[model samples]
Target: MTGRLSMGSGQPIKLAERRVFSDSFKPLYNEGMSLVERAAEYLDGPGRVEARKLSRMAATLYAAESMRLTTRLMQIASWLLLQRAANSGEMTRDQVASEKSKVRLDTASAPDNAIGWNELPEAFLALVNNSLSLQNLVRLMDEEIYGRNAGMTDMPPPRRSNPVSDQISLLNTAFARG
Candidate 1:
């Protein structure tokens, strides 16, 4: 079955709240299986087998990353709340707010435009909050894809380190070759 690509509206989209199950995780399952199958078709004998093995490896990595991203999202949510508290001069302000304002994860718009947990400052409190966000995201994704505990096996996309890092690296490589 084919599925539609969804965009976040402005409100938050909690897949966990929706109670999506393993059956919902069909998209990812198909993707994982397809990667392995395609690798098998393109690779011959040992190479084909290796391709399949790599596919599985990629799937595993994706799952782990998905879990991590979920945790980070939760952390970000908590951090946002905490900031609100601190802004109001709470008794204990454990986390420091960013010098600049941060955009919250509002499903009311788009995931691509959403500020990710990783976008938070790389500091102690930020890291803690980021982790929480990741955990939450994974929980939600799992529930959304496969109801209950099924989402636990979700394979997510690779975690690209620092958004600017990739750009900088590409530029450096280009200049070095010149």
Candidate 2:
């Protein structure tokens, strides 16, 4: 899935747009969107009730954790949306690439041992953990597809002067560039 596609013809994938349209990307898109919806539901419903029970210090921590979880999910959703746009031809790959620069894929979670970490509800913690995992997966998949450097230009190798240099060597021995 990370590399070129092959259907037994043994050729490298030539269509650049295939990065978004590939079959492997579909499941990831679905998973990310599902997580986003679930997180929103939990935060607005049961999460509000659970937060009221927290001690002052733990309540503060819960607020921070919820923010992080929301931020992480939003970023993942943004990326997935961009890819979906490309998949459906709503936007060109070039447009997606330009817009993608704003999507941050390096979100991180607070340490498990942080002061009030143990006070968080198990369900809330589970959602945070799941979002973190999905974020990491999306980041890796993005890196594999787009590469480590954004807007990376895969320039072809410099052409060789062997033929010209050979001719030159034949005519004049010491001045060849190859």
RMSD of each: 17.5, 19.4
TM-score of model number 2: 0.73
- Which candidate number has the best lDDT? 2
Q: How far is 108's C-alpha from truth in model 1 (Å)?
A: 27
Q: Identify the runs in model 2 with alpha carbons over 4 angstroms from their true place.
A: 1-19, 149-178
Decoy 1 TM-score against native: 0.23
Q: State the lDDT of candidate 1 residue by residue for 1-178, as single tens digits.
A: 1122446766544543232222444443343334334333433344324324334333333223333444444333443344344445552322333311232332111122222323322332232333444444544443343345441233343344454653443344435432
Backbone clash numbers for all candidates listed:
44, 0
Reference-based TM-score of each model: 0.23, 0.73
Model 2, 16-118: lDDT tens per residue? 3364587766888888899999899999999999999988656766776787789989989999999998888899878988898888876656566655679
